[model samples]
Target: MKFAQPWGRQRLSFLLEKAASREAQTWRGYVAKKQTSQDADVSPAQRDEAVRWLTELHGRLQLYPETLVLAVSILDRFLAPIKVRPKYLRCIAVACFFLAAKTCEEDECVPSLKELAASSNCGCSPSEILRMERLILDKLDWDLHTATALDFLHIFHAMATASRSGFLDSIGLNRSQHLGLLTRRLYACLADHALMQLRGSVLALALISLELETCCPDWLALTIDLLRKAQMDSSALIRSRELVSRSLSTPRASLPPNTVYIYHPLQLAAPARRPLGTMETPRDQPALPQAAAGEESKAPPPSPKHLAHLQKVPLRCKASTKRKVEQMDVDDFYDGIKRLYNEDATSAVHEGATPGGGAYSGGSSPCPPLQPVGAS
Candidate 1:
């Protein structure tokens, strides 16, 4: 005789509740008061630059999406209390991600320090990264299990799939397949810094709405109320849902096709798409030149393009260093992408197009209209 499965709606809810409590502990740790005197003098723009650098670095390394999320959470928690110069921030991010990989990824999957240095191009040395790792671990008192938005996603997905409900039937999806798509879309949202303030559960719940909304327009309002009952701030949940929705809808050339999500669990999903063979460093743009004996290399400052992308708001720099280009705030950037899709969808709707040709057309993946960011 077969044993009964221990999963169902009630069981899943109990698990989510437990995970939420654990996640709250992690959030409290993240939001703990920082010592003002030791806090970094850097602007939000500066911190965003560091986050962007890590985004590119994680992409090049072809690490799992959760690795990137864990790395960023680690970086922000470390940076919250200490003041480091702008130049050193990139090194700190590299170290944070490296440490995070060791915790979240398999031994063979984690990239070596030399590989990371080659991939990043920001001129961080292995020694510098190692030093930063030590500093981060000690500063946080050696706790590496900080809960992240991805953590909550795992619980939520398991619950939604455990039962054979009308919700899944109405959407016309396989439990595993849809969960994979949702996970990919969830990773896309983590790329933005604006939604970083929302809790992991709130973000996960919003993503559920985002995926379901394509088929069930009424689903979002219902989800909003459900999350509110779970003790999330209603206003914040709505705003987070919108941001997640926008990020998912944005069209980026770098997004992965849906096939990539079919084979693995979210935790061990395939690595992001990467550049062709050979991880050689470029000679012309070395960020850190080799140093003399007994000297450590300094962290290289961010490139102009990277800095501009992260600045979200315009800054008045000296003429010698100014960039004469239009500035798009982070919110506007995602919103702009979202708007493009909306126009196309609107036009298709007006034309009375069928499902395949319409905005909700099932293209490469049934996940969402939003593309998954490429591994690199």
Candidate 2:
């Protein structure tokens, strides 16, 4: 009864399917035209360089599959919008990772944009990462509901369990061991370098195949093989496994988060506290209660500054009630305001200060993106 008719579950699947359909359709033609047209640009060397960098990036972070998938999904989505070359390679990859960690990780301890900027060979500063994130989000049109590794985890679990329902139910399945192995295999999914290859969809497919091969091949792949339901060829699945192995063989392939990749996951421009002599910011400036306990929710009258910001997100409010900013014809202007206001408040508190106080700098750059290949 628990999973049966689970409220909103259907919606999740539907959204993921819709997004997948769109990515498939849009990319198919785009790939063909680019491949045939000399004007399409991007040489083999460039492609290899992109793949190697992405692979290096994937290796550097110690995130679980959940976080990695989120990062990868964000990168893929952002790729569609922001154009980059080896020149700005590390900056874009790092920016995308920051966005993904914020989106997926349960307990994040990454570094601040400033700290990362200090270490980056890319010469991109904290403000630069901050600016790039906004550009990335704008490029992707603020779509967040991508199918990360966690989403796929559930699917794989159900399929595996379904195949063994009788045996598992009767023998009292050691769900923990099984799940542990599955999670380790799942982490490997993040290593596919799908972000650079323009083959992220393959990563998901490859991950599922590897999980089956390593965990419960009988349940997942064997079942699929018997049913002949999957679209992938058996030989392709074998190649996917080999690639996963080859990725692991390269030690430089993945590494834990240091100043290089993982940031503190704090706000972008939050710590810029103005001197007391400065004029009080307009009704728009966002602020947070300084709960030394790091617990602001318990505060009784959490500064109206915080409340002033909450009312900014574009919730499902009636159009008549929405702000003039929200009513703007352009959707991103509406979104930028939300991030500048709502998330800025929360991100700022963690940053231990206020955002760049009312600079009003457009900080615009080339559009970047992240497409939730699994959802709308």
Candidate 3:
């Protein structure tokens, strides 16, 4: 029998949407949690050490993306219920990764107990590894399939790049590549406990949304709507976006040399841009006045295009005494990007088929891979 195409546009779109929604629900429902008070009992230094070791172990194994994510989720779930002693942290982490490799990776890809112990130098006996795996399974009720932000991120990328000709839509070519890079960065950020407060869907959607604004402005509205349909919490989404933007916009000079190395070579090659989509004014245009000696300067009036963009977004008002004017300027800048999307939407749809889409950098590392556990 002749087989049908694996990915007709409609079929692929449906599959992507379904996968996104299912994974989003699974992550938010089963795995999402605030940093537990129990974590406080363990010194931040100890937690950081364990996380760093886990990162090295994961990299050395060359594990699949799903395996690394699953292992980390297991570690989080296990720690949430009961605090393990600091000394055994590496052993527990190893067992978690070992179990994850078995479940999510091919048999050939999974490492043997002896190999794992030697590589990590944790001195965990095979029997100890088995016992810890059993303990973790019992604590987690054997629910080893927790979805991660990377799960949703993959679905979103497929959807954004969906094409009938087995090629990525050119309109989103740059975006798809940039989104992949940002997604990897988010995974790197996962090593940080503060970012862990966000659920998978929120983090994935926020990073995707921001990249869409930067590289595929035309797709911004549709992506946002799909994300909202996927049940991303509104407040969480905003906070996640701000966090991503902040991290991306931070000056390289301000970041530690090691922190900068976590990014893919593409990210490392480019200088960081300002947050909130601030564009450089034409040099010929008059510069805006500085803020008055003590009081804040009034923001320049936004053009009509900027007003229209704000009209598209759901607005919120929170009263604050400090930096109120600066906040308004930031709001105006985002609104302008939304308007840019509206203007470019038609052109993007008409010229969808373009060869040679954006290229993604290989390999992944967490953002600022090493830092003081609670520095930020």
Candidate 4:
């Protein structure tokens, strides 16, 4: 995670070299050729739509950004080898996303096939996704760890930070924040099929170079060093930088063509209209008393039936007498005992009952009243 470190330079160089080689071997220009023809199997517009779909699913599932980039790479690579119809593009896209999530995310973070299919709403069943997954794996030869543009973006960003510490301090962003901004820009560039012509290393370097020019004073020097390290041509980096700048600057359409907007008004009902030929006169209108008119506007009182429905039902206590006595507080138990003694004393004084009959006497009670025992 430490971007300003010297220990990772060798690893960064190796990653850049691997990504460049794989891109050269696998990347194709099929989108450009099919873009102009309406009957083409997969047009650039369709590919862009598919990529957008994968981006949305990535956010919806809360997967890592790397997963999204890897998914798009898998989709593009799969499309290069096989011709997919526009209708099946979404199914293919979902399959790629599923594969990427399994590869990049932890086992627990990866969604089940049913959940992914249902949540993505790509009009694909779990069976269809499973089948497409097999197809993609076969076509890709089960190699889903290919480096993408995001990988290069990370390398260049780390190298920039390592070269000049606090270069992004002026912008008030830490290394990760600035790198996240660059990652989003790189994702945006990926959505445009036009940038597909550029290799992953070049595209990522272009985005990084664009960001560096704005903040870093030695941006040109830094970019030159990255180009040398990545072994990318300066002309290609220049072209891709222009495309990335334009792509980020341009706003894309937010909604699809088939989108429908629904509106609901707050009014209860519309006022009734008079007949076209009707003429209203003062004498023809009925006169209403002030009290009646005021009453008419007020809400009516609830009926007896509604009042009955609103009444609360009392809950019944189910405790037995012994249970209730066991649960009683000490004060309440002593109070009850004192009341019984007073009642017995009062009865004996009135009726002159004998002490043997469990009555109270003046000098000494027949038997001392029992005291309440505290529970342990």
- Of candidate 1, the 10-residue stretch with the lowest lDDT total is 317-326
Identify the runs in model 1 with alpha carbons over 4 angstroms from their true place: 1-6, 28-40, 163-173, 217-229, 246-376
Candidate 4 backbone collisions, by pair: none
Cα displacement (angstroms), candidate 3, residue 49, comes to 4.1
lDDT of 2: 0.49
User: How well does model 1 score by local distance difference test?
Assistant: 0.64
Q: Tens digits of per-residue lDDT for model 3 on 252-300? A: 3134336644555554564344323233334576644555412442333
TM-score, structure 4 vs. true: 0.64
Q: What is the lDDT of residue 282 in candidate 2?
A: 39
Per-residue lDDT of candidate 2, residues 1-376 (tens digit)? 0122222434544544554564554332112113444435333345334434444544565544455556556655555443455456567767877776676555445656665566444578878888888888787778755545445344445544555545344444555555555555545444434323423444445555654554453645454642243244666555655776666556544553243655587567743443211223235645543663246222222324544554343333122534434434334543465555554444333322224433232333243222335864
In model 4, where do residues sit more than 4 Å from their true spots?
1-7, 29-31, 35-40, 253-376
Q: Write the per-residue lDDT of candidate 1 for residues 95-207, one digit (tens) a residue.
A: 98888889878899988889887788757789888988999999989997866777677655554444324577777785665766776666566655566677778888788
- Scanning candidate 4 in windows of ten residues, the lowest lDDT window is 309-318
